[model samples]
Target: MYRTSAMKQYQTVNIQAQTSGASPHRLIQMLMEGGLSRLAQARGAMERGQIALKGELIGKAIGIVGGLRDGLDLEKGGELATNLDGLYEYMVNRLMQANLKNDAAALDEVSDLLRTVKSGWDGISQ
Candidate 1:
């Protein structure tokens, strides 16, 4: 039998919390965990250059790690774009998809992106 949405959500969260560090594995783990707010935080990290994809700074991990690459690198927090307008927009879309469809895959995708961003901005404060 297929897992229920609540069950899926629980699984996703568990994965995120359990996984630490900036490994790509942890990023994917977080997506499955479920949390738009966390995702947004990650995005902010990426835009600021606190996270690296393929060893280079990436503003949008979504374009790169959709399904490819072994993993990503996460730095501490730092300043992102003066205006985080676009990043927020995409995050909302991802959050909706995860909530409405109960799509763990989609959540996983967005979560990775967020983690990359979060890693980049690990040290910086809002």
Candidate 2:
């Protein structure tokens, strides 16, 4: 219990630091990183047979994807935004499947997709 609290506090502080003075592109990158990190954790939890923790982590990943989707500026991003929304929806569905079935492959698939997107995003100079 003490360790969990300390970890949460550490994460909270880390997040606050990351967000402070961040540009829009940087914020999106952070969200992608956050989702990827959660998915990795969910995979580890699944390997450990920690069902509840796996679900929690998967849920957090889904929320991060949803946030990314929601943050898209359709007017500015145009077709790319639309495509990303579809991809995010697919990712969320796969995450739900992973949670329900303890399917590590599904998690891996989503993680790969997110990494690909993140890589592309990283290439853009902002």
Candidate 3:
């Protein structure tokens, strides 16, 4: 179904609720989930030739990736943090190209990278 106003409103409320109760680890998980979702949506929009929507979704995905990068603890996380920062930057760059070129393959590549990162994150004992 098409996104209705109510759907958007509900999503906002739901995210607020999740964030309020979530721990830092859970929040990271949510960000990964959101990034993946946006990439998929953006890809669909590209396939459908919805250029504007694709741009909007890709922008949101980039922001989410940037947020994740910003949240890294460089001092405490050390080399892992540095590596992740590089990966996030690469993802953001690829997303920009995907948006400009409407390349679904680039979107898929980013999505795969996110999934790999998310899997590593999910393995941590929380």
Best by TM-score: 3
Best-first order by TM-score: 3, 2, 1
Any runs in candidate 2 off by more than 4 Å, and if so which? 1-19
The per-residue C-alpha lDDT of model 1 at residue 79 equals 34
- Candidate 2 global TM-score: 0.85
The ten-residue window of minimal lDDT in model 1 covers 54-63
Which scores greater on TM-score, model 1 or model 2?
A: 2
Which candidate wins on lDDT?
A: 3
Q: Comparing 2 and 3 by TM-score, which wins?
A: 3
lDDT of 3 by residue, 1-126 (tens): 112422443355348757699766777888888889999999999999999999989888887787787778999999999999999989989988999888999999999999999999999979
Instruction: Please give the RMSD to the true structure for each candidate, in Å.
Output: 14.9, 6.0, 6.2
Tell me the whole-model lDDT of each prediction, alpha carbons only.
0.41, 0.83, 0.84
Regions of model 1 farther than 4 Å from truth? 1-83, 123-126
Model 1, position 25, has a per-residue lDDT of 46
* lDDT (C-alpha) at residue 41 in model 2: 97
Q: Encode model 2's per-residue lDDT on 5-118: one tens digit a residue.
A: 324533553476576977677777878898899999999999999999998888778777877776778889999998998998899889889999889999999999999999
How many residue pairs clash in each candidate at the backbone level?
16, 0, 0
TM-score of each: 0.34, 0.85, 0.86
Clashes (candidate 1): 16
